[model samples]
Target: MKKNKDIEVRIEETKKTISGSTYDVTELYIGKKKIGEVLAYGPKEFQSFMDNEELGASKSLDLAIESIIRQWNLHE
Candidate 1:
């Protein structure tokens, strides 16, 4: 776990395939602990995630970060 101040967003290659295609995965980490990942790399892929996940936040990035922090109990 981390203070969230050390939160990092990183991109890496993966052999995993999604929807019959493969993309460089983006991962979120708090210090050394990985919290989440996104299989989408482009705008279309991101939109796919939003649609499939049914995320309705107007500010998706902010909401995603906040959600992760909240789940990690790092909002304190």
Candidate 2:
């Protein structure tokens, strides 16, 4: 996918503990700012982590509106 100048995407892997349990972690960053994170058990963990509310919470109402604007501009 083509990268957008206004928004940057970054992904990193780390370790985290939840409820006294340790697991692998995957984090998403937008322009050097962390937006959300995900946790899982194995190779498919990254996919599983994305279903978390934290990822959804990253899409605020304002952000959604801004994204729509950007999309409209690109199409035009």
Candidate 3:
């Protein structure tokens, strides 16, 4: 089994043209496969992730990564 660090997630914050506002994701990854992730974000920005579509999709990747890691452990 791989430790949490073995997993990875990537995220890109959405930018607002009007107010120059932006938000970051707490976690992000490819479809059903996590390579790495950022676990922390600014207060208001972190909340935005909960309502962001990108974040939702990334969550699936995270799940897949976890599953893969668990399966690897069983083999070990």
The top-ranked prediction according to TM-score is 2
Q: Which stretches of candidate 2 lie over 4 Å from their true place?
A: 1-6, 43-76
lDDT string for model 1 (1-76, tens) is 6554554555333445768887754455656666555454454433112223433232344445455445556433
Give Cα distance to truth, residue 22, candidate 2, Å.
0.7
Instruction: After superposing candidate 3 on the true structure, give the runs of residues whose Cα lies further than 4 Å from its correct spot.
Output: 1-59
Q: Candidate 3, which ten residues in sequence have the lowest lDDT sum?
A: 44-53
Best model per lDDT: 2
Work out the TM-score per prediction.
0.40, 0.46, 0.25
- Looking at model 3, residue 10 earns an lDDT score of 50
Q: For residues 1-76, what per-residue lDDT tens digits would candidate 3 score against the true structure? A: 8566443335543333324644332334444643333222333222212212223222343453354334434543
Stretches off by above 4 angstroms in model 1 are 1-16, 22-25, 39-59, 74-76
Tens digit per residue, CA lDDT, model 2, 1-76: 9876665556677888878998866666656755556555554323222224332222333343344334335544
Query: TM-score ranking from best to worst?
Result: 2, 1, 3
